[model samples]
Target: MKLSSIIFIWGMLLCSSLNLFAQQTDFKNFETRESTLDERWELTSESSQGTFVVVPYKPIYILPGRWSNRPNKLPTSLNPDNVAKIPNDYNNFEARFQLSIKTKITSGLLFGKGDIWLGFTQTANWQVFNEKLSRPFRELNYEPEVIFNYPLPSDASIFGLKPKMVGLALNHQSNGKSLPYSRSWNRVVFHAAFEYRDLSFTIRPWIRFSEKFDTDDNPQIGNYIGVGDATFVYTHKEQVFSLLVRSNMRLNNRFKGYADFTWSYPIKGNLKAILQVTHGYGETLIDYNYKQTTVGLGVSLIEWL
Candidate 1:
């Protein structure tokens, strides 16, 4: 009864059971970016017939995370020197959704050259478990973008980099505040993605659109969130791992680097257990400069989306 032998047997059994369940999967309810991009998106009760749907943004999950942050609350003012203000709760339940208003437009109008999509993802940080203030949602960030994904040729190379897919997006991210706490930015993002076997890498660089305001909101916000982010995705069958890194390059990245790591494993059909770890900053719009480390566990409907 060697320990290694028992573990091996258990692993084998788990794989076999997962495979059996997968073969019996309906797949009609599975939501993933890959499946959606391939025109195999999940169907909702309000879905239109055929590949196109009214709401193109796929529903991600019912619950996203239950997290505990190291530096929980942040200063009410967006000042680096100010200490965190109180009257809040930490270690809360979080929920996220990705939705889109479909324009019914695609690359077909480009003479079948590529695929174009308009989508938006909104992330909300909620203190659901706290009864102190009726469990208020702390922050909400909206990201809307128009993406055009161009399939890259196998032999394509730009600046000694081989890109699997190239896309340009007109992106706008904002917290939708009137003043005092208004944090928003507009960008023209360019992304190049590369894939090697089970590993995927996406390089996203953005140029910020100039604003005509007299003064900037959260002037030093870029030092915490950075101008660009690179994501690494690794998948092994039912298990998925993703890491995202963002650093301010202008200051030689003297700022604390931001990193997010997520590991997801299938739990049931269209559901997977998610363990997410984030460090540095930019967990929420209001707390962009508040650095903290957080670990969370929850369920995810789409791991790679």
Candidate 2:
């Protein structure tokens, strides 16, 4: 998307969130927990270097054999799979890391009601089992986002839904690769956090900025990755449950979506046992057009918010 368009949409969301901020009420039903349910308003002390840490957004893990329908993509020159192309090796590993450009730190800034954070996350699909090819990288998607969050009064509703926090972000996501396999896009995302007792939900809707012609790698990316995604996170004592639904706004003939279901339990301080299930397209930029279902289980360092 063009840089100018991103700026324009960001400005509008900022204004809308600010106006809505004044109307939200305070929510106090669920006491925040350390696992996956960190309170958005939680702040750092002045004595600390309060910038947030980013990088590892999802808990870094290795899910061996992510079995997918299509064969993994490899550069023609690397022709390691002898056949040059065949069903994707059903024995690769999936791993991701998010680096902190100061994402973990949380300090009050901007209107003194919100915190600013910068973070980058990279998800890679690897062909680790293909020993002949020395295990090559099939795809790596990069996500860098600048987020500004404002705590809304947790007491009231905008459209009958209690709002807990509001956020605005400029996100750029791309696979650092070339043609026939390249993918990239930018968006301005607006989020509203809500809670009703133990049920907490986040509604995130974004506007993909206008891109110059011939620049869109995946013209119908929104149809796969979706127009927006909503996350529902619930806590039962120390157990955390989450469901993420990303879907096209479905403006008639154009509609597609994905669903991710996760169940996590505390394993140690900040560490949790995690199992993730996903079904649909856009699992990654390279698989933006491939539909598949995959299951992964591993230790999690962080929970999706």
Candidate 3:
């Protein structure tokens, strides 16, 4: 059977299971738990690769609330468990993979809490693109990054009237090879986020800043001051939408932006189906663009526990 058919069937099963469970038990009567897994897959298009994101949360114990990096994970859509190959075309015919895992430690605060985080990711690429010919030339490049986010604070004003939250993060990325095709530089990044919740919506707005240093000390583009990025996300039951904008001086005065939408529903049992669309400019790695539209549908192996 085709993969799409399989995913559809599985999602239906999950929805069925959830309905049955909800009917037999009084979810409202039960107390909320501290730890939960809200893992899910958001598919865009068959032509575009898929992303599986796992978001895990721990109850508000040491900290007023919880903190995660997207605290979410994405694998390839085809396998969902494995990293997938990046699609290539005449404008972008290259191979690259990047993954970042973050761990957080926390301390209690008066309004909310504080956390320290660490993460790293890297990607290398080789591509040949030709607009006129069947095959194109080749270029090579790679970058690896590791960074630490020190303790940041939050409060009721930050989380909304409901609770308070504040956060801070530091980030850095460096190119590994000196292939003239790739730009090599080290960057220092800073991030801050404020969150608020209303009866129907949860919103998070974040800002990021970065400074770059050229490893080769190239005068033309080396050691340039960096660009900054800002992002906002709003989530309602079964729906999530977000926007991100970034400016980079290194890319010939290029500006990038992305808008994304995701909707999910349970079909039956412990299965669920999700639909997603991401539009961007500059690069998919940074934002959603129309040059590519990724449509995907996926089923959960099990209910979110």
Q: Which residue segments of model 2 deviate by more than 4 Å?
A: 1-49, 52-60, 69-110, 154-162, 251-254
Better of 1 and 3 by TM-score: 1
**Candidate 1 lDDT, tens digit per residue, 1-305?**
45356436644754564445446443444443342222322212132233233343422332345555553454444433233445455544554333233333554434454656666777666555555555556677888878776665656565554557677889888888655456777788998777665566778987777754445556566767888899887877768898999877765537656898888888876667877788887777777777877777766555544
Residues 217-272, model 2: lDDT tens digits: 76666777888999998878667788998987776766677888888877865556
Error of 1 at 161 (Å): 9.7
lDDT of 2 at 287: 69
Question: Worst ten-residue run, lDDT, model 2?
Answer: 75-84
- Superposition error at 82 for model 1 (Å): 12
Which candidate number maximizes lDDT? 2
Give the poorly placed runs of model 1, Cα more than 4 Å off.
Answer: 1-65, 76-104, 109-111, 154-162, 212-215, 250-253
Error of 3 at 219 (Å): 9.4
TM-score of candidate 3 versus the correct structure, residues matched by position = 0.41
After superposition on all CA atoms, how large is the RMSD of candidate 1? 10.1
Span of 10 residues, lowest total lDDT, candidate 3: 58-67
Clashes of each: 0, 24, 32
